[model samples]
Target: MTVVGKFLPLLGWVLAGVLMAEPASCESWVDLNVGSELQRPNEQTVVDQTALVRLNTRYSAPVGITLNAHYGLAHRVRLVDEPGTGIAAAQSTGADLRLWDLPTELWRSDGDTWVIEQNLDTLHGVFYWGAQEFTVGRQPISLGVSRQFSPLDVVVPQRIGAQERSYRPGVDAVRWRNPLGLTGELDVGWVFGQDNLLFARATQQWGTVSAEFTALTLNQAQWIVGLSTQTFAGDWGLWQESAWLHDDVLSGARITLGADRSVWSDVYVVAEYHYNDVGDAENMTSDFFQKGLVTLGKQHYVALNASATPSPLVNLNLGLLHNIQDADTLLLGNVGRSLGNNTQVDATIEVPLAKQDSGTEFAQIPLRLAVLWSTVF
Candidate 1:
């Protein structure tokens, strides 16, 4: 049996115990999401279409405990208009799969063109007491100050140009957080398994500025230290994060600086710059996908994002990413509207700009259009 199958019965027993033992109030909710995407490559003769459905549930008890879980189903179809235009692509684009690393294939056929996958995105428990909190099981952990690019967020880092509706994958860990004072706190966590991934962070706030320092140990041999800070300058917000890794194999520093400002009441713009000393500028595509040393593979990058809400129920977003060394660019846009109190619809497009050669980074990505619908009950 699969890991999820073995754990389901145990989870059911625990939920029953919680419901029977607690005399306090209990709350539950469910969410349903459906998404479709189409891709057209520049020189390819085939078009690809993908469909996905996901269900998520959450339960909270008055005893200061909560449970959450998610399940997903997806299908992909390829149309071959020309025989020579069909090419296989990579299964995943990013490399942040440290936690909950399970095999995703439930069933596959037709030369792997048709596939079925099941994922358990989140399955965690939380307990609270006074100013202290404890959490265990599979959960998401993110650390950093920058919004677009975070150099300090090494664990389960965000992927660039991925679908916005997809949730961050959870990792199995035990974590603790405690309040130091009115404006200070401390967080500590240890990810399970053989890698010995342990981390601690301290944060403090003063007036309109906040700062954090973190230390991480990997496999009991390598260490990484990070610092991040955020502050307001007049009407604009500014932040920076930096991290240095000490390891025998690869040792370097990564830094990110970002700023954002509101243009009007409903519009805002953001810009960010990132630098990674461990990245390669000459062979970006191979370095990023094969070696997994850096997220972008380029030593220097610049990113810009803007969002506007013309009405209460509609929003528009635009994003641009440029590789300074390779001169490749990625452009993204999205439009979303609220259908009612419980439903929303969104449309998005992604286009990559690069040379025709396969060696270029962005050129390998096909032009993509996606639509998503979600409802909550």
Candidate 2:
């Protein structure tokens, strides 16, 4: 048997206990999406400095498929496939099977629940790890209390291979969670044999206000610090976040503030401003602070987004942005339609109404359209 094959059952058993102990109320759902973007030289979505800049936007779309199937054999044993392998040039399938809720009594006394959640993006199976209960394996790591700058987003699928979108494989590592009255986590990972990627986070609640802090060490480049606070006032929710990054050469900060109002059922409007200190002329750019650039370190912006779900199978989003530094403007519109229980389709278009003086001419006329189909069983 292959090495991976030999370890399957043991890993399955470990994952089962973790899932039953902390299972989130969920249902098995499979998602397949195909999308494309249009723009000019270096006018695509913002990413890290370590990533290559695409000179031209073309007919690129996510062609991959994923699945997560769970069978509750008993109250304590569930069999499942994390993301059925369908990702290699040689192997058309990327499937991994796991067992959930084995020997589920580990945390019955704690009044906490466990759920086994897996994604196609991270191929590794994660069980609660160590004394901290850290979910380990290939997983999504969201750092900080704010949404603007996420320094721990290494496993994003679109960043690794062209066939996948918003999916990424987890690095080999151990993660821990501390739930002793407060909630927090610490994670350590090795990417490309470099073991410097470390993450720590904590969140607390006090009456109507909450706060969170997140910090990280770059795999080989920098250190990041972030903090955020949020409060509810009447029908509006207000929040703010600030982050700083430092390394051997570069140094910068980002501040973001926003408010959201839910005036109706299942509908909301949000206004946010993100200001990035993207200048470090004396110091080289650090790898950890790459996604902050909406225009490659050229502009600051305030954006408004409105979202509504009219039904269980339909969703819509409308966005407008104004670049505070360069006076550029942007408009975006998107909609999604669910085709079945496991399949759906969506489309997005972004238009730049004004251009910055950075001299990237193609950024003036960025447009895109795409269609996708996916399934699981």
Candidate 3:
């Protein structure tokens, strides 16, 4: 079926539900964003422009049921000053670049200069009763302890440096959660697809500490177990997450440890270290584009991020990521300013540091600058 054919049916369903809902109980909003990026690598320069629109609506029925629907439209264009640069590199590398910035379900390429896409980010129904809730349809399910990187976020993991981090891609699934006690809960979910995912998680809290344990099965063949925890000591926050996968081909573990603290009431600093026992240091750069157990192919990684807000209207962020095995580093910096009540603007820059080896991970990335403008209505 065509993309429009698939979208029209979903749109009709949502509209029908909205019509049946109470008039004053439905809420809706539209968000628009425009972004431009410039990248330079070697002697080549590339420019990309993108526009995105999102329509979100929620309805609360009188009988404790809630419906949420979110739709998105996007258009992107890329221009390269020289051949064999930027996206060309990505294409030659055989990386699934579309997964990084575009939706996969409903999209089409328009000639060689433009790409248009549409997607349903969320279409879910929830039934709430006391401390128990059941959700069905497409929705996001996140499980982890770390904020920046999570080894245990196996279900619908967010892409690194994603533009829309607020919402991860939703999965077709059924999930149930119930409170175990005053400070505990149990969650179970099943995601349907070719490689189906089934998992159960238990969470507990004590004082200023919280912990979670999960067991998951993939395709009824591989098993994965995860543990994560977070605790507060004085003014510092500490977290750790670990996952172990049992498979014939890819059997190993990944772990991450992190700490964060606030300074001067307006500045926050965070540091994290990640270790992937299954990662390959020799093939780190080449294998990075391949689908694998580890998100990053290098064995060890360290990252530091700091954010400061000098005033209510402006925020500054700086971050650094280092690949210990390959000795490659990436520097990130961004500034955000609130334009008004419902608008904002941001500027960001990323610089990769590595030897002049085309195979190296950081060397393949260009120095990039991005400007973004967004507004909500």
Q: lDDT of all the models against the reference?
A: 0.73, 0.47, 0.75
Q: Residues 1-377, candidate 1: write the lDDT tens digits.
A: 65544875897798679867876554555666666666767665455556566666666778788767666666555644455443353254433434445567666655555556666667777878877998877788787777767776656567776646235667777899999799999999987642446899999999998999999865655667999999989989999999886665567788999999999788999999999786765544442223232566667889999999999999999999887888889898999999999899999998988755757666677787878888887
* Candidate 1 C-alpha error for residue 318, in Å: 1.2
User: Deviation in angstroms for 37 in model 3?
Assistant: 1.0
Tens digit of lDDT per residue, candidate 3, span 88-202? 2112122221211234324434434456677776887887888899987778878887776677776656655433457776766779999989999999998764346788999
Query: Candidate 2 on 1-377: residue-level lDDT in tens?
Result: 64445776897786565555552433333233233333332343311111111111111112211112322211111121123211112121111112111342222212122222222234343333234443433444444443332322332312111122333333444456565464433334432222335666677778888777777655535667778789978998988887777777666777788888975888888887777675332322445324221122443667787889999898887777666666666667778788887666766666666444444322354443434343443
How many clashing residue pairs appear in each of the predictions shown?
A: 0, 24, 0
Q: Estimate TM-scores for all models.
A: 0.85, 0.60, 0.84
For candidate 3, the lDDT comes to: 0.75
Q: Could you arrange the candidates by TM-score from highest to lowest? A: 1, 3, 2
Instruction: Determine which window of 10 residues in candidate 1 has minimal summed lDDT.
Output: 284-293
lDDT measured at residue 339 in model 3 versus the true structure, 0 to 100: 99
Model 3 TM-score, all chains together: 0.84
